[model samples]
Target chain A: MGEILVKEKEIVAPGDVLASGMDYIPTDGAFRDGENIVSSLLGLVYIKGRLIKVLPLNGVYIPKKDDVVIGRVSDMTYSSWFVDVGYAYDAVLSLKDASSDYIERGADLTTYFNIDDFIIAKVLKVNKSMAIDLTMKGPGLRKITRGTVITITPQKVPRVVGKMGSMVSLIKENTGCQIVAGQNGRIWINGTVPDMERLAVKAIKFIEQNAHKSGLTEMVKTMLSKEAKK
Target chain B: MSYNKRFDGRKFTETRPMKAKTGVVKNAVGSAMFQIGKTRAIAAVYGPRELHPKHLQDPSSGRLRCHYNMMAFSGSGDRVRPGPSRRSKEISYVTELALSPVLDLSAFPKTVVDVFIELVQTDAGTRCAGICAASMALADAGLKMKDLVCAVSVGLVGGTPVVDLNYEEEAYEEGAVDIPIAMTPRDGKFSLLQLDGDLSKEDFEKALALAKDACQKIYEVQKNALKERYVEDKK
Candidate 1:
């Protein structure tokens, strides 16, 4: 029988033997070498049934289809707009995907979306060369003009959003700030009181710094309350 | 007379004390510092982001570029030039070769992972120290790799095999042969091997065995350093 070598939630480095034998399956950041499952990244080990994978604590975001991302328009072509979505290559936003209204050919593209303007976009496709296609025609997808954008490590986004977005909802309910968190780690915060916006940003950063720790939800709530009082 | 006693009072199989730490540079995606005796090297990892110069990017796999530099006052010899010298350039090229075997950049096509290694102090084994630090930094950066690489210099000090030679022993008038070796400990594969002096085939084999053992010890230090980056935070 195959034997698992590492404990659940144990931190593993690259080349660390996670399991030995063919009975176990490896996925994600873990791979099979001969009969042994070896971790290919420095991260924590997670085992479910016979499937073992390592979840990374840090890394750049690779865009995926259907992921809602916050991007800034870097340039415009005659037919499409190039959005910088924190990837190696710029994502293309074609005119048809930009809006529901019919835009005439060669019409002023800047009037619809200009350079340096941020928008909430959805990834439509990613080709073999990592070329990305983005669309802004979706619910909650539009130009962002009235909020301050802040970024955290992409790996911490899941934690900042929390389980079913409980963490973000808590922050919103308490601080009365409108917050939108993109899977790419960019967050837009808009609030009536500048102080509350600042507090929400601080709470998000605190969640990022302590993302790996347990009891993080309580800690974030405590921090938000203390900071709001000042 | 043949060289017998080590000047520093270390055994033939003993290496100088080693110290290693990860995440030294706050701005870098990954960074580390490694010190072996008087030699110290710091490395920072960036990119796998975007590769500039449209022509150089490869569609199938990412590129690895290493820059090896010694601070102007870091050398025991005369002051180092501020810019890249021929020796530094060669070392940089070899450093890349030493690290590429374990690194898997297939997931990040058309990009580059840049490693910057700076020597803040020097004695001997600067390249080996640099390789160790760079390996840790790459791992800390969350890059996928087959295994970590460990390196050490093994040599014959006048017919006696030594695990890691210090600067004084390298300059021993009686004659010493320094052979720097880098290995992927798990696979027992050699990624780097360079000879600076001569030795008998028999002595070379013996020293190679010692070097392999020494590398295992260095590997332990590297593993501990990486784990400490997270483990220490638990306290």
Candidate 2:
């Protein structure tokens, strides 16, 4: 038998013991020491059955394979385009993986994706050396045009998307904005009226600042409605 | 312990006034400004993002780098030069070592976390104050750390060990020994220890004990600084 020390959604400091039992297993943001599972970060604790993990309140984004992300074109080489995906190493987007059309060797690569252009792409692969491979050929993957992009802490992206995307859908439906919430903490919002776009940004910021609070979805819904009428 | 009165007109174990706040720099991930008596230092933390110059990237875990500098007008008399000095380089290295133990580096692999500390005002014990500020900046950046690092300097003046020496006391003749120690307050384990001048074995032990006690008081202040920041933001 093991004892669980923290309540659900409670803020826990690093090195705080989350649980003690041989039957319990540690997950993300937690590590095992002897018979205890200790939190390794400042975060909110979530326990599911015997598996316990901590949700960090703040951190930079770490890209994973198959994640949809928004990146800016940083540099161009003979055969590849380096994308700044908010990570240490620029993700490589080779011409071959970029699109279905074959690009001629030595052809000006800027015509396809120029420097400082934002693109919504997918992570094709991440290697042992942390070399990331990206692709723009997938569905919903293309260059972003004429929309405002806002960056938030990547740890809050899940909250912005809400459970099953109910939160995002509410924002889109009320404001009539085409919003794409990237897992990398970059959001793309295009609205017919500039006020709507600004409203969406404000709502997203609210989510980022108050992600830990309960009843956030209801609060966001009320806020959006009040702003939409104005 | 026979010194009834000291240069600062305080008891031997007394410390200077401390004030600290986090999130001062808007651009950096986390930032803090700390002042102990007349000694003030500001620290900023960035990254867990990409580590540039790919060759320096560590494969197993994120690298922690610190830069400690003193501003030109921070000293008492002549203005210091604005550049990296040997003393600054050594302090930066020790500061990095002091903070590395508490961070969960493996969580952000193939990245780097940079902490920059600048001494805005110098009385004495600036490096120790810088260590304290850097720890708060790291926490304000929301990086996962096991425990906050708290530090204070203990020095021997007139054959008596004193806590938190001032500028004049630190420059005493008679071979005064200044020992600065940094540790994780929760566990009472020392992460950084440096000795300047000379002390006997028995005296060094006594100084260490005094420093450990002073660290506990400093830890309370550090904890309160962090809580105050978050509490205000909640409202």
* Candidate No. with top DockQ: 1
Q: Could you tell me which 10 consecutive residues in candidate 2 chain A have the lowest summed lDDT?
A: A8-17
Tell me how many clashing residue pairs each candidate has: 0, 1
Off by over 4 Å in 1: none
- Candidate 1: tens digits of C-alpha lDDT, residues A36-121: 99999998999999899998877777888999999999999898899988877789999889988878776888898999999999
lDDT of 2: 0.86
**Can you write out model 2's per-residue Cα lDDT over A91-163, one digit (the tens) per residue?**
9998888878777777887888999999999999987667789999788999987889999988899889999
Q: Model 1: C-alpha RMSD to truth?
A: 1.4
> Residue A129 error for model 1, in Å?
1.3
Among all candidates shown, the one with the greatest lDDT: 1
Which ten residues in a row are the worst by lDDT in model 2 chain B? B226-235
